[model samples]
Target: MVRAKSIDHGIPGRGSFMPMRDSIPRRADRDTLRRELGQNFLQDDRAVRNLVTHVEGDGRNVLEIGPGKGAITEELVRSFDTVTVVEMDPHWAAHVRRKFEGERVTVFQGDFLDFRIPRDIDTVVGNVPFGITTQILRSLLESTNWQSAALIVQWEVARKRAGRSGGSLLTTSWAPWYEFAVHDRVRASSFRPMPRVDGGVLTIRRRPQPLLPESASRAFQNFAEAVFTGPGRGLAEILRRHIPKRTYRSLADRHGIPDGGLPKDLTLTQWIALFQASQPGYAPGATGTRIPGQGGGAGGRDYDSEPNRAAVPGGRRYGPTRGGDPCAPRAQVRQTKGRQGARGSSYGRRTGR
Candidate 1:
């Protein structure tokens, strides 16, 4: 029988591409897949509850990216009024759909990246596929639809997004709009196939008072790219390319940012001050800023890519473009904290898409 893949998402091997093979899924045992992909799919019941507990569903619907085995989906339906899931594996998509037939869950069998995010989906929660974590996050950050997301991503990713030790290129690009925080750490043992790295719970909440206008996203993304990739060891020297040394010195004096601070050490406020001080005078068609390594040419990562049709896949869409590329969303949700996820064992199945 063609059983579903492991808990999280399939472990994709290095330099090895796993095709969706919607028409012909080769027969293989679960262990063989683990050996082939090195995937860490989430399956631990306690971990599932823990992951869901981080989501603050304030009377809004929840959209799950990859409801592998439906463990997290099960917990979500118990508290939220409407639950929507996108599973790429045909068998598991059918399986998850069957499990929640009567509940207030809407199961769509399709790639989350290609899927058209439904309107008014305020909260997005998932044990995301590790391979395309950055792409998936970029997709989410590009859209102004949802207000918050609670995700179980790679440990390093969690810390970086939360800006714990230091910020990453992606995190710095989005810092003006969202607030990232890292919660608990999930051990490798929590997964069925047991991935090599541990998972971390991360929460993303939109800022009520954005330092910059949403219209300036394109310019800001480019501005960030230049600063991060600038040719200097310290920010003071690097920023000299954008702003005059006199201005930077004055700002540093006022903000208390060390003159020798590295790019990673910049806080949100400091970054905003630097950008505003530059006074790029953003016009409608200003040079499109791209997220470094996320796009091409003079411009950076372009948010205006192919539109999401929200089409229903007849068969399963395995790993083929499983992430990246999502359209707008419906509404917003105010992330509510301190709510423990309710337990569930309805369908009783653990193996998932």
Candidate 2:
């Protein structure tokens, strides 16, 4: 549970104090506030300064979330002409109001996601709550109201959000429209009552045009989902299940692909090529061989070795090989000896052994 500190108005350089009638309860009063709200405040002065520096807004309208203890709020007030803060904790909101007082800061005691962004706000900045960070980001991304945003979030989440190609499906889906990059990492020890995990700051810039067409985007998402279903299965097997068998064969034929199938190490481009070739009436040149159980020519010869040998009918010798090598001579001799032994002494007496 997060509790907001009491507002102290008389302090010099501190902003005006405004108390919320329904502010978040004090930690001492109720421990549940922090637990439920995920309010881990940013207490490091250097980190606060770095976050402000990364935002780099002067006289611009800024929207901030979770301004715990006024640490980040103070900086925002100093740098931006109009800094609007939405803090769930009433005490913290009061502290921010008193600290910034007559300066350019407006403290709103409410949930950030529910709060509306002021019109014409160009920049959004906050040390966002970890639990709702994804939702908040999605809201911001979906809204065209802000020009850009700088956010401080959990290091792992930030890494996934900003990572290339290897990021989560959500990140990949959104990548075409927004560019996310990490600015720096803030140590866990830097925060007061330090959090268990470290933090990172990231900047996001929205793009004007998406990378893929709307139709292709859906297909790509479906493709990604199918490929990542199981860890050990080959890519070809997965694709074959999702795509039509005839379609698969046709694509293999058009692209000159081997009957076997695509290899596990096939690149993204190659996968895309295979998908493209599957489209009606497309063919590619054959370049690679396919393994059995995936796709290959008839005869089913072992690609890497001689055909497996099997036992011959009514005899101990094995079947003949294609190379004309009969069963080993030792095998024939062993068979003859076994037959003689079966005839036993009776035959030996009759034949005058």
Candidate 3:
């Protein structure tokens, strides 16, 4: 059994990342506080109540991320059969452990991305940090053993994930297996140290049937990324480099895609059809040839081409690493308090497909 350490109120600012020792000493210094800004603690009572309600634990096992000060954790213990919290800050972890020492709460102190998901975890919930919201969502979507998740993330992120403005590359990639939705909007003032932007309660549930076959996961993901981020005037031009423009244009017309429209303009079902038709052995006149490194296409960038492909700014490469794709397991948490406002502010804006 893990022993809870005594609380050290001397430390001024809340602990953020991995401290020097397991028993982290609290210091309210400006520099220390700034480093830990990514681990903002949720303080609003109303927001806490709303988050718990959205979770709908109902006797299920819940895994809460960054349970700072135990605002939500307090309610989780009452609703969940077992509540496991993964906190990166040692101080906060200790505090949670001590607070719920006799309850069905397990506090693990470390980076959540690196933490293992137990076989019994049925539900996941958290008010994710602005800097690592994308990474966290990707992790949750990819991980198994969790039936559903209710997360508090940046409002713009919630919008993109739910395909409000236009489908994002990441959202499009995952649409085959997971369904995402925006449940409620949480104001910026709901947090203790108010964030510049508002928050949203986003819920993600796995689909009973995936749109694409499991074998096509890799090809589908890469294809979606290239189409969204690849250089081109529109979908036609993007595919023209790999297939004949006439063929692509005909397919686009058949799918009701407007001329000169970008990839985001198409719906999820349309993308699936396009990807299926673009495979290497596609039909003679109607279907277009596939691009190398894409679905069922000829050889291109091998899995081991790069140990860890660098992450594209505002974009992420998720799923299991082929070789040691450095960007596969995004470990670094960004500080979102600088000139850019939030570190991943780019993801919030409309993606220029």
TM-score of 2: 0.59
Off by over 4 Å in 2: 1-19, 22-27, 56-59, 213-353
Question: Candidate 2 at 50: error in angstroms?
Answer: 1.2
* Model 1 lDDT tens row, 1-353: 12223222332432221223334345675446435433456878898898788887475688888786788988997778788787656556667766777777776654555455655687999888777677567656655556689999889889978988887667777776677999999998888677788889999987655545544455566667677668887888899998778777776875667878887888666676666667645222223322233232122122223224221111112121335323211111112211111110111112110
How would you encode candidate 3's per-residue C-alpha lDDT over 4-78 as one tens digit per residue? 322222222223234323465656653384356475567888888888887743467898988888999998877
In order, candidate lDDTs are: 0.62, 0.56, 0.64
Give the C-alpha miss distance for residue 105 in model 2, angstroms.
2.0
RMSD of 1: 13.3
Better of 1 and 2 by TM-score: 1
Task: Tell me the tens digit of each residue's lDDT in model 2 across 46-85.
Answer: 9999988878434578878788787887787667767777
Q: Candidate 1: where is the Cα deviation over 4 Å?
A: 1-39, 280-353
TM-score of 3: 0.73
